[model samples]
Target: MSCIGNCIDHACIKSFHSMIKRELVYLEKFKTREQAIRRIFEYIEVWYNRERIHSSKGIMSEYENL
Candidate 1:
């Protein structure tokens, strides 16, 4: 939904944005644009991808249905 209207719709990005808004954006008050950008970048690159326990990992990495 955030991307162009003609482009493909991705549910994952929407979910991510919602999470970021709830967890990071709502909690912090940035004094400058640069700080906000840096924090968001770090939040995703450092914390979310590396430390977060993703529910999709098993589905994506090892899919075995019995």
Candidate 2:
């Protein structure tokens, strides 16, 4: 059980990192701190966490699974 929990946690972290890299860090150019913050928040809250599909969850968002 503990191992499963750890694996899931690690996977979640890795997925988040990948999402950040792919969606924000690599895709956009931000000239100011506020712009970066707003973009990151929008990607994480509005898109990645809310709308993006996860293969592990049968192509459903985490919010959807919950």
Candidate 3:
């Protein structure tokens, strides 16, 4: 097996965190852990993957980019 593969995964995660912070975390005021979890789930499943237009993919959502 090869030792090196997709070292950018860490970077990808960091970038995702940065984006989530900018787009949702910093904008919303959640009162509880439950609310935060629910909102984060919706942001990922509904907005980020399905609705948000990824610049690299040009008009296509992250799901489409996959």
The candidate maximizing TM-score is 3
Q: What is the C-alpha lDDT of each candidate?
A: 0.81, 0.77, 0.84
Which lDDT tens digits does candidate 3 get at residues 18-59?
Answer: 999999999999999999999999999988777444555577
Ranking by TM-score: 3, 1, 2
lDDT against true structure, model 1: 0.81
Off by over 4 Å in 3: 1-7, 51-66
Q: Per-residue CA lDDT of candidate 1, range 1-66, in tens?
A: 555873348677888899999999999999999999999999998988774354456443343343
Ranking by lDDT: 3, 1, 2
Query: If candidate 2 were superposed on the true structure by all CA atoms, what would the RMSD be?
Result: 5.4
Clashes per candidate (backbone, < 3 Å): 0, 0, 0
- Tens digits of per-residue lDDT, candidate 2, 1-47, equal 35665776587679879979986788889999999899898888887
Two-way TM-score contest, 1 vs 3, winner: 3
TM-score of each: 0.63, 0.55, 0.64
Clashing pairs in 1: none
